[model samples]
Target: MISRSVTARLMMPLAICMLMLCALAGVMIYAQLMVSSANRAALQGQENVTELGELRSVSRALQRDALNLINEPAGEARDTIAKKFDGRMEKFADGLKKLEGLDAHSFVPQDYFDSQHKVAQQLADVAVKANGGDQAGALEDFRGKVRPAEREASKVADERIEALGAEVEKLIASAESADRFAKILLLVATIVLAGAGLTAGFLITRRGVVIPLLGLQEAMGHLAAGRTSIAIPSIDREDEVGNMAQSMARFRDQLAAAEKAKEAQAELIVSSIGAGLGELASGNLEARVDAELTGVFAKLKADFNRAMEELQGTMQSVNRATTGINGGAAEIRQASSDLAERTERQAAGLEETAAALTQVTTGVKETAEGAQSASNAISVTQDQATEGRKVLTEAVTAMDDIQKSAQEIAQIINVIDGLSFQTNLLALNAGVEAARAGEAGKGFAVVASEVRALAQRSADAASDIKKLIQGSGELVNRGVNLVGQSGEAFTRIVDQVTEVSRLVKDITDQTNRQSTTLSQVNVAVREMDATTQQNAAMVEETNAAVSTLADEASRLEQMISQFKVGTRRDAPAPVAAPATVHTPAPRRSYRTQGALAVAAAPADDDWAEF
Candidate 1:
């Protein structure tokens, strides 16, 4: 198409050249016509001018013969005059004959030629009649013949001269007309030659050279500007411009390809870096990359992920340990509460027993003061035990809450671990693809490696956290056991203390109310002591159970803290060309080069010597 445009552009010069050639030919033809016309006019004018001159000379000869006869004796002059008239008349007739064939319109003296010839014939007739007369009579008769005829002949001669003069004027007019036509033809020829020269010059300058070169210049400009998509103008001809346009188009394609390559290279760099960063942030370790740029980013990402995983793992371990410690603390709190509860029950029983003793003392008088003092000491001990039990129960409740939180944390960590594994798999796929991509995939491979490593690291960290949580759970169980044991021991102590109180009470009753009242009081006191011990034991068991629950919560909380489960990497789908399209590589050709070179030349044809 570009070639065609170039050819069309060149056609202007050819068209102009043809027009100029036509003009030149027209001028030449016109000049030739004028010359022919002028020559014809000149030839006809010359012939008429010659005939008129001959007629005038013949008329003069006849006039001279008539004059000679009048000058000599008529008889002697008659014969001579007759002979002269005869010769002159013959000459005049020949002149008339010459005039007769010439165009009358061309020669203005035509009427004069006719009149002179008639007068000359009349003069000749009279002269011939006078030659045979008597001498005197012939002389007289010759006078009569010559005089009148001579006068008429002279009139004709005068008219002939006047006509000849007019003929000269007509010839002059014809010559001038011919000269004007010749000049016009010459002018036209000059103009045609000039037009042809200019047209030829213009054509040579424009079509053969200028437009094609301009096109090439434009193509070069586009190339310089990095416009690889430029399209050359179409030209019809298989000429230089056409070829050049093709070449420029090819060059544009090459440049476009190079541009695409550069773009792809840049994209690869960007994708690789992006993938690497994504992997690192996602938390993978042990990932390695060998990207186009030495895989520095990928390696860095991998290392970072590894460090994060290790840190998370360590945190998880610490969390687990803390959970176990929390559980143990809760169990300890429960056991202490149980022990306190049991002690309180025991103190209560002791106080009751002291009270009974005091009553007995009261009945016995001397022992009454000692018994009262014992009762007071027992009451103080009971109050202290009750306060301690309340503190233990509160501590156990706190431990249970902490354990619940730890369990939730553990669940979250598990989720994070799963996500990390998925990320690793994705990275692995990316790496494989990059590897398969060859040179172009180098960057992607590196990113994939980083992602895989991060995933592994995250998994490891989660595993460690899980272990920690398990350990903490065990510790929580142990604490629970300790609490249970403490609760049981506390229960036994409370029972023993209650029995002492009952016995003391029974003694008081006996001292106060004789044998029957004392035995009944002892039995009622023992039953009350047993009931108090059972109540204390139940409180201790409740405290222990609460402590165990708190420990479990703490472990869960520790596990949950390990992961940010919802953390996600969002990325847009990559763009790709249709699979069916196959882009061919650049090819080499000379046509393009030659066309370009030719098109680059200046179109003015300054080197044309002509």
Candidate 2:
């Protein structure tokens, strides 16, 4: 807000100039728009003239076509002329429709199109009559009617062209008049705004910047010369100059106060503080300021007396602290010795633990190896059982084939026994027929008897074979059952062995993990053992440092006891100072090695494996 008041004076005229420029631009734009509109209208007028001229040309073309069509005889020539006339008619009609769509101010009118249409119709009628063999009548109508109508349309086109030219001239004149008026307006506005801007700038600069700044400058000069009584001007204004005036006023007030305070402090310091400093230099800490003062000097006097008294009390506190430090140093020495002994024992214990872990890790590794071996053996057993199962399956199939073959053999044997019996009956009948004959009958009877015996032997052999096959079939059936049962047993064994292999694999993996875990534990324990040994060495150094501290503490107590300091009102009964010890500044890097925890256990689930 303060800055805006200062800058608005500079910017106000520029804002007015911007507004005036906008107005000038608006006038220029309006002029330009009027000119563009006039130009477009002029161009439209020219197009209308062109359209009128074109229509005249089309009318002439249609007249020629009609004349040609009427003179032609009824043949290909007449038909050709008729086609040309029709095409011209269509072109003329299209022209009339296009002119109808023109703007209201366009030169083309309905009366013009109606006249052209009447001329085209008369020409068409002339052609039709001539083609119908009434050439004379058609010629008369062409001269009297169509020709007159065409002449009238040509006159109308000429008038329309003249009217368009006049309208275009009027539009151009109006645009020129507007442009001239806008130019004059812009010139006058520029001059008026320029004069106003200069006047406003001068007035604002004089009132807002020059007058206030001059007054402030004079006041500031007085302030620099230490004439702080002068009043700063323009502080009530909301401007940068006013803010500077206020700042100057504050600075003057502070300077006057500082001068007064400095003079007072000088007199007060000599009267009161000088003696206290002299006593302090002589190590007389009990001396302090008691004189009363005011303003900043009052605070100074209180601070000086308080400082001297605090120094006296601090010396007495140092004396008591030295005594306490001596006793604490003695305790630290004893504790250091005890800590060294414990550190040595801790190192020994860590070494033993590490050794035990190593043994356990080795055992776990061995167990893992055994489990792996068992897994391999189980896998091999599983494969062998699977092979035995396959063999038993094949054996059962072979037993089945044997039983089927035995039954087939029994059927063949029974057929053989029936054939033999039939042959024996035939032989008996032959023998009876031969006995009824003479010598020939005797020879036939001997042959029949031999044949009968052979048949009986064959039947007995077939019967024996059939009984043997029946017994073999029963044995084969029993063997098939036994082989099938063996195959099922072998399959079960394969499954059990597969399961055992998986169990053994799991055991091997678990044992391996245990071995790895124990190895890590062993390494950690060994590291801790080494670190503990280092800590023991550090503890020996700590004991030596503690002894030195005790001696320094005793010496400090003797030194503080020489100072003359006030006693405390709330003092406790003093403990007797121990042997003297001097303490040193704390070591920059005192490090303690925290013991690492090592997990020690037999493999998890080890006993459960049993």
Candidate 3:
């Protein structure tokens, strides 16, 4: 059960807590929404009451204004009062419309408000009619009909306003109660859920972990204190605790066996190698254990004798090994010192190389950026040149159109000039005929003379207009040629700018490539420099290790010399050496190192021409 309940212990409590919190939140939100709705309704009711009060005031004002309009004589004073009455009428209608537009009016009956506004409209009519003529009749209707109707309507509005006020108060009270109830519910729910959650969490923790852990803790404490004789609880259960308890039991059993085995081994070792131990203590490495014992003791006896023999050989071997180690240590120490110095020199050189490359990279990157900027500027110049060419072309077209229009105007002026010349010729012919008719034709002759003078003036005016058109035509032709020449110049400029832009772009590309290669080389050099520095450090460490090894070898040899061995000239076979350990060289990842030298340059803004 405990094993299967692992997931439950972690998940169930959290699920319960979340469920409780979500449910509480839902309830609180719903309650808040309800409270908000009620509050809004109450506010709407208040607004309606305010609108009704304004309407009632406007109604009373309308009555006074209407009365004034009826009583004031036919004069400016009455006209001014009439305007006031109209304004009051408008205000009264607007107030009624505002109340009718309210959300409260949507569900409430509108008949009460309808009857009220009807009274206001009737009173307006009575005042209007009285202002026009029928003063006595207007007064009769104003008092008997309009006044009574307004009173009744006003009474109804007052009742409605009072009722709305009461309803609003009820809503306000209800909202306050709901708000308080929602707050209480939220608080109580939170407390209850919190308590329940805490209780559930405690039960899960106690059942799953605390109780079992307590038992395990006590058992472990006993085991740590070397109390392995007692039984461990939960060992038979199939759970994590059971597994732990079982492991401890196994450890206790093994510990007891080790103690017994140690005792038996101690007895056998003492009985078998006691003599050899005594000889060994006496510094005699020739002692031998000849007891043919059984089990591990048999091997122990052979081992004792062999150890003595090996000790004899080892002592003799140490004498020669110490001299060799001393010589080797001197040679190694000299070699490592030289290596360290060389490594330091090499590292310094690599560092200098890296620094130089970095500077070169920075310079090249700047050059590339400068080239790119120049290229961009040239491209912009080219674009402007192209746009200027477009404008010039449009100007040329406009100049050509103007020249055509001037030519058309010149043709029209020539037609007018011809017409005026024909008119002058006809007027002269008429005067000749009039002169032939004698005294009666004298008036006609004068009229013909006037006509001839008018014809001449018309011809002169047409001639002037023709001359101006010809001049304008010439100017338009000149303008067209100038615009065409400018267009050609702009085209040439655009071509030159485009070529310059292309050349600058080429330079930028080359500079960028160079900068990229330099940066990659810089990165590679840094990697190599780092690797060289690591090698230098390793060499220093090796020098220290060699020194330590030499000291340890000397101490071991001196210690071996204290033992008394037989005259064993031949040394036993030396032990095979363990594999040497080496630290790997530092490396860096440069994915583009090989390609950097052969590939096209990068177009990055950071790249320089250098």
Q: Summarize candidate 2's per-residue lDDT along 37-136 as a digit string, tens digits.
A: 7656665665666567667778777776766666556788778878888888899888766666665234556676777788878887887788788888
Tell me, by lDDT, which candidate is best: 2
Ranking by lDDT: 2, 3, 1
Colliding residue pairs in candidate 3? 364-608, 365-607, 365-608, 367-608, 367-609, 368-607, 368-608, 368-609, 513-601
lDDT of 1 by residue, 44-90 (tens): 54456556655755665665565445444556556667777777777
Global local distance difference test of model 3: 0.65
- lDDT against the true structure, per candidate, is 0.49, 0.66, 0.65
TM-score per model over all chains: 0.33, 0.40, 0.40
The residue-by-residue lDDT of candidate 3 on 361-462, one tens digit each, is 788889889999999888888888888899899888888888888888888888888888998899999999999999989999999899889989989998
Please give the distance, in angstroms, between residue 93's alpha carbon in candidate 1 and its true position after superposition.
3.1
Residue 418 shift from truth in candidate 3, angstroms: 99
Evaluated at residue 599, the lDDT of candidate 3 is 16
Off-target runs (Cα >4 Å) in candidate 3 are 1-12, 74-77, 103-110, 193-207, 236-239, 250-610
lDDT, model 1, position 27 = 53
Any idea what lDDT model 2 has?
0.66
Residue 352 in candidate 3, Cα distance off native in Å:
75
